[model samples]
Target: MANTTDDTTLALDAVKGEHPTDIFSLDGEGDWSPHITESNLPTKIIWSPTMGFSTVDKDVLAICEEAISELEKAGVEVVVNDSIWEVNPVESWMVFWACARARAQQHLIGTEEYESIDPLLRLFIEMGVTMDGASYASAIDACHHYNYQLEEAFQESPLIITPATCGQPPKLEGDGFVNGEETASWVDFTMGINMTRNPAGVIPVGNLDNNLPVAIQIIGQQRADLDVLKAMKAFEEVINFRERAEDF
Candidate 1:
């Protein structure tokens, strides 16, 4: 497992400029505080394709509809934003991330080799997935693109809400696979924000039958993640969105 602390340091460097990095920032500043009390809170919200609402499985969809209605019943409003696919294609992000991984591996894999880079690019090209905006060819480029988008989105709202995973949090315990098996690897919707260097925290909404809990991810712009956290704390007091049996 990559040392969590090491990954955090590298991720933070990508955000705050080099050297003299803000201590409060390299550490964390918490969420953005747009308002102080309940009366002043913005009723505005934004949601994107989540646990459901974008497929034709036709089965298990009732579960999704009921879940959405429950959220509304709990006094929380749903804000629909971009589709799940807007974030980036699974292949593109993975391929791009793999290149970054490979570059990080180069020095250790002996003589500055680009061994890992070639295949990912070739696979992406062969699949005919648009590589026009992909940075899979260059590790720096991929990280740069990820960072750029993070800044762009958060710049608008000191906060933005997105599904914690394109799906749900994986069963964290399973036959080990660094990032999990191929089938589960791409569930990391949270990582893009991680790669951006903002402090994001997750709170359990409730559990799914398989026992994995769903979490709503709160993200903040720049150095104001603490405000996001604070808002989440506030949100919990008034809204009780949960599973039918979640008794909370």
Candidate 2:
């Protein structure tokens, strides 16, 4: 967890001039405190333990830390706690299977034409081909679980910031696909939003030492899509992110 320190540090340094657009304390709301704003940056960040993985590369953590720190120092409120609920493993698979099934149905009905598709995608279609009643029940359960968690988190804070990806962009292979494990890592920071059906967006903030882009994700409650976009637009004005990129 501490491994993200360096990358996050550099990332903050990269976007030195940005400032907060609005500052408000969540003190009276729930179990969270407004004073977390005064603590060291990471201590103020809230991540879900249910989203655990085997290993997070040092650089991945670094970028994450940097983004959080910069946002905090600029006067945005941050919360360090388990603020969201967890979904069952079966529920997670059911969502994926449902999406795959739709894709397979599209292909079967000849909606579009392509010379070929990725082998993994083909496998996904096959997996979804047999979706049953149990699958539908699991999907509904997952929807409710995610909506509840999102509602709980939003009750504490209006905005949630997270790493856009687990780490830097992957080096695409000749087959145009990374291994299953690596691809999974890339989506670590994102798939939860998909499953939860929340509105989220990615804003490019800085670059890694190797010139790879680093982005921070902004997420909000369901049906608050416009509010989420407005927040990002305000952030864009404060960070003036494109000007920073031009400097690079």
Best by lDDT: 2
TM-score of 1: 0.50
Off by over 4 Å in 2: 1-56, 82-115, 174-181, 238-240, 243-248
TM-score of each: 0.50, 0.63
lDDT, candidate 2, 97-137, per-residue tens: 65666565546533334226555655566667656667767
Tens-place lDDT digits, model 1, residues 112-231: 443545665444343334333335455445556666665654433455565454453335543212123323433455445545566675444545555654555666666664465555
- Point to the candidate with the largest TM-score: 2
lDDT of 1 at 225: 46
Q: Give the TM-score (vs. native) of candidate 2.
A: 0.63
